[model samples]
Target: MRNAPTVRFEAITQDNWEDCVKLEVKEEQRKMVAPNWYSIIQAAYDKTYTPLSIYHEDKMVGFFMYGKDPEDGLYWIVRLMIDKRFQGRGYGEAAIRLGLELIKRQEDCSPEIVISYVPDNEAAGKLYERVGFVPTGRIVEGETEARYKVLR
Candidate 1:
């Protein structure tokens, strides 16, 4: 079988904002990550949240947002979601890995990148652990905090 197409990231721009907001996680995952619309709104109103549109080839596949907690300088993945139509094809994994790469590129960024997930979201937990994030036994805004090292 031929390998899957590589994933690419495009910074969220007004030109394609509508396409990005249409991306959403599965219905069952509604609680895992906030809706892409919410993220887009946050990105617009929150200076720290930088949203990116994830694409495979030329089609949009997901959405990702991250930024530093300005007060503490802690890196944070504010949102990540594979479009319901694109779920279960490894797009989420590819998108997340790419997101991490972008975070690691930050100048003066924290050594540890942070993300939080609802405790009962096992799928999110597994995906995160599989990608090298480990639970810090910390909670932020009612979600469990997981951390990943980011130097490269």
Candidate 2:
């Protein structure tokens, strides 16, 4: 069996923004996360949000945007998605792990890293849980919130 490709995070730049926008989730998961374009749009106006393209070797195959919440100083992984063409290759999980590492590099970042998923996306819940995130029993805007207490 072939092994999964190494995943790396790259800043979304104008030169590659179009590539980021073109990433898409599976049809059945369309409702679970915002479209890639929307994520790019949101990152544009949100000073705290940082959008990143997930690269597997030389190809962009997924997207993730995360940052600190301005309201209360908490960090949040607002969006993460692997394109339909790249799903099931372990990219999403690898991206989140790298995202957490990025968060760790930020000064004054809160110990609790937050993320949310559609209630029905058990796959998302499982993936995050595997990285030490646990549900906080909180729901905002119909999505369930979970926290990863980073030990640093």
| TM-score of each candidate structure, all chains considered together | 0.91, 0.94
Give the winner by lDDT: 2
State residue 23's C-alpha deviation in candidate 1, in Å.
1.9
* Model 2 spans > 4 angstroms off: 1-5
For candidate 2, what's the RMSD?
Answer: 1.6
Q: Which 10-residue window of candidate 2 scores lowest in summed lDDT?
A: 1-10
Clash counts per candidate, in order, are 0, 0
Give the TM-score (vs. native) of candidate 2: 0.94
Model 1: pairs clashing at backbone N, Cα or C within 3 Å: none
Residue 52, candidate 2: alpha-carbon lDDT: 88
- Candidate 2 per-residue C-alpha lDDT over 6-125 given as tens digits, one digit per residue, 9 for 90 to 100: 899889888999988878888899999998888888888887898889999999999988989888788999999999998888888888999998898889879899999999999999
Tell me the lDDT of candidate 1: 0.85
